[model samples]
Target: MIQAKAPGKLYIAGEYAVTEPGYKSVLIAVDRFVTATIEDTDTECGSIHSKALHKDQVSFVRKEDKIVISDIDHAKQLKYITQAIEVFEQYVNSKNITLRHFNITIDSDLDDASGQKYGLGSSAAVLVSVLKALNEFYHMQLSNLYIYKLAVIANMKLQSLSSCGDIAVSVYTGWLVYSTFDHEWVKEQIITSTVDEVLIKNWPGLHIEPLQAPEHMKVLIGWTGSPASSHHLVSEVKRLKSDPNIFGHFLKSSQLNVEKLIQAFKTNHIEGVLDSIRKNREVIQYLDAFATVDIETPDLKKLCAIGEKYDGASKTSGAGGGDCGITIVKNDLNRENIYNEWSKNNIKPLRFSIYHGQ
Candidate 1:
C-alpha cells in the first residue's frame, strides 16, 4: 500500500492578476490536506473511493491509455482524480513501466466535518496527492517539479483559465512566491511534444520561490461561512479583458503590489508587508469597482476592518465573493482580538498553521 498527502493552500496576495502569465502571487500551504492511498489489486479492474465525493467506490478500467470510470453519474465528481491518473499514466508509459490495476482511496480535511469546502484549493490538493501516490506506487521517484508539471497539465485539461499557483503550493508545500507559466505555450507543446519533453523543457514565465515567514509574524484565517466559486469569479474578472484600460491597470497594479509584498517578505520588513497588503487590497477594490464584481462580501469587509482595527493587515484570500480572509499580525494579542471580533460577526476563525511538507 502507498499513501501520500498534499496540503491545501490560501492566497496571501495576488489573486485576479496572477492568472496572466508571469504575474506573481504569494501563497501558503495550510495544515489541512487531501490524502490518497493506493493498494495493488489482483483483478483487472480497480476502484476509486473518496470520502469527500461519493459514498461508494467507483469502478474504473483503462481503455486504450485512458481511465474510464464506470459510474458516469458520479464520474464528473472525480475528474481531478481521473485526470491525474491519465497524466501519470503518460509519464509512467514514457518510462516504459507497465501499469497495473489498483484501488485508490481519497480522504480530505480541507473542508468542515459536514463536508463544506473552505476554498482552500481542495481540487489541486487532490490531484497532487493522487500523483504522489502513483509516483510511489510506480517507484517513479519523480521530482516535485515533475509532479507539479503533471498536475498543472491535468488541471489545464479541465480549467484553462487557472493560474495553478495552488498546485505549486500543494506540491512544494510552504510559503511561496509563484508566477504562472505561459499556458498557451504549454497547451500547444502538449500536442506536439511528449510528456517527458514537456517536463524537461523550460516553461516560459513560470517561477516558484520558497520563503520563510518572519518569526514575529502570525497569520490568522477567518471563514465567511459562505463559499465562493473561484472559477466563476475568475471568469467574471476575465470578461474585463474586453476593456484593455481597466484590465491592464488591474494587472499592472497587482503585479507591482505583489512584487512589493514579496520584497518585504524577503527583507523581513513587517511594516512594508502590511503596507503592501493594504495597497494590494486597494488594487483588488479597484478591480471590484470597475469589474462590478462582488470580490469582497460584506462579511469579508467586516473581517478586514476588525483586523485593521487590531493593527493587523487583512484582506480577502482568493477570488473572494465569499470564503476566507487572511490577517497578518505581529503578535498574538492582536490575533486574539481579531478572532474575537470575527466570532462576534459569525465568522469562524480557522486555526490552520503553515504546512511544510515532509
Candidate 2:
C-alpha cells in the first residue's frame, strides 16, 4: 500500500496579509489529518474512491492505460494533487517508468472524528498527501522544501490567497517566528516537546475541542458558513501595497499584530492572543476593499457572539467570505457547554491539536 498523510493547518497571524510580497503569515500543523492510500492493481486500470458517507465530494478518476487520477470537480479543493502529479510525471518520465494501474482512496480523519472545517487547511493537507504519495510511488527524491514550493504552485494555481505560511507550517510543524519582510524564516523553533521544556514549560501541540484537555492550549475554531473570498481582496491589497502610504500602514499594522501575538505566547496569556487577533482583523479591514471588503455574513456575527463569552479572541480565519472563523480561549471557559451549544446551532466545533516535525 502506498500511504501518505498531511497535517491540517490554520493561520496564526497575518490572515489576509499574505497576498503581498513583504508580508508573512503564520500557520500551525494539527494532529488530525487527511490521508490517501493507493494500492497497485494488477489490471490495466484502477478507480478513485472516497469515503462512502462523504457526499461532501465526488469520487472520480481520469482512467488511462496506466492509472491517472484527479478530482478537480470541486473548485475549492485546489489542484494540489493534479499539480503534484504533473510535477512528478516530469521526473518519472526521465526514468521511463511505465505507468501501472492503481486504486487510490482518500479519507480524511477530519470528517470522521474532527468534523471537516473549511478553515483548517484540509485542502492543503490532502494536496500534501498526494505529493507525498507521488514521491513514494515514483521514487522521486523531493525534499520538504521542494514539496512546499510545488504545493504553492498548486495553491496559487486556482487561489491567490496564499501567504505561503500554511504550506510552510504543514511541512515544518511547530512554533515559529515567520515574516516576509526582514526575517523570512527566523526563530523556526519546534514547540512540540510532548514534555514542555525551554520556552514553554508545558508545551502541548495544537488541540481539538470536545476532547481531552490539551497539554499546552485549547483554541475554538468557528465557521462563518459564508465568507467573503480572500483571494481577490488579497490581490487588491497587494496592489495597494505599491502605494507608499498604504504600504507603510499595511506593513506597520501586520508587524504590530505579530508583536501582540508574540507577547501572548511569551507569557502564555490567552487574552493576549485574543486581543491580537481582534486587532489584526481591524487592520485587515483597514485595507478597505482588500479584506472583507464586501458583505459580512451572519455566521461571522453568530460565532462571534458565542465566542465572545468564552475567552481570548474570536475572528474570521481564512479567505474570509463566510467560510470559517477561529477563537482562542482565554480563562476558565466551559469547553463542553459551548461546544454543545454551537453544535445545536449547526456549527461544528473542531478539536485542533498541533504537531511537531521530526
Candidate 3:
C-alpha cells in the first residue's frame, strides 16, 4: 500500500482580499493532517472508505473516462476523492498509462472524534493527500507545483469562490506567503486546454514563497465551539466588490498589512510582526463594518482580548465568523495563562505546532 499525508492550515493574515489576483496572504500548515492510503484491488471496481463518512465503503467504476460512484447519495460526500482521481487520470492518460482498480482509505485528524470541525482546511488536505497518493502509486515523480495545480483544478470544480491558499499550504506544507492566481484566467483555460498544457504554462499572478519564522515569536491557536460557513461569509464579502471604493480600500489595507508581516518575518523583527498582526485585525474589523458581515464573532473577540491581555497580538484566522483565531507573542510571554483564559471562555486551545513538511 502507498500512503500520503497533507497538513491542515491556518491563515495568518490576508483573508477576504486574497481572493483577488496578486493579493498576498500568510499561512502556516499545522501538524494535524488528512491521510490517504491506496492499495491494489483484485476486483474490477475500486472502493473508497472514510471513517468520517459512512460505515460501509463506497464503490466506484471508471466509465467513459469518468469515475462514477455506485451509491448516488454518497457521491456528493466523496466528491473531492472522485474529482482528484479523474483529474489525475487525465494526466495519466496524456502519458499513455493504463489505469488499474484500487481501494483508497482516508483517515483524518483535522476534526474532533465527535466530528466537530475545527475549520482547519480539511477539504484541501484531503484533495492533496489523495493526489499525492495517486502520484506515488503511479510513480509519476511530479513536482510540488504540478500536484498543486492538479489539486486546484479538482477543487475549482467543487467551489469556485475559494482563494485556494489552503491547497497551496497543504501541498507545500510550511510557513508561506501566497498570492492567488487569476481565477477567471484559469476558468477560461480549463475549457480550452488539456491538463498537461495548463500545467506547463505560467499561471498569471500566482506566487508562493516560503518564510522562516523569527525565533523570538510564538504562535497560538484558539478554537471557538461554533462552526462557520466560510463560503457564506466570503460570498457576502464578494458583494462589496461591486462598490470599488469600499472594496478597493479593503484590498489596499490588507495588502499593506500582509506585506509588513512578510517583511517582519524576513528581518527577524518580532515586534514588527506583532504590530502587523494587530493592524491586520483592525483592517478586518473595518471590513466587517463596511461589509456588514460579522467576520469576527463574540467568542473570537474574547479570544483575541485574552491574548492581548497577555501582551500578544491576536486576530481571527480565516474567514472567521467562529472557528480558529491566531495569537503571536514573544518567547518570554507565558502562553499557559492565555490557554487557560481561552478554556474559561469555552474556547479550546489547540495543541498542535507548525508542520514543517516531511
**For each candidate, what TM-score against the reference?**
0.98, 0.69, 0.98
Instruction: Please report, in order, the local distance difference test score of every candidate based on alpha carbons.
Output: 0.92, 0.58, 0.93
Better TM-score candidate (1, 2) = 1
Best model per lDDT:
3
lDDT (10s digit) by residue, model 3, range 127-187: 9999999999999999999999999999998889999999999999889999999999998
Residue 319 of model 2: what lDDT?
56
**Higher-lDDT candidate of 2 and 3:** 3
Q: What is the lDDT of residue 181 in candidate 2?
A: 20
Off by over 4 Å in 2: 44-47, 50-79, 92-101, 109-117, 139-142, 154-161, 174-215, 232-244, 263-271, 288-292, 295-298, 340-347, 355-358
Clashes of each: 0, 18, 0
lDDT of 3: 0.93
Clashing pairs in 1: none
Worst-scoring 10-residue span by lDDT in model 2:
202-211
Top TM-score model:
3
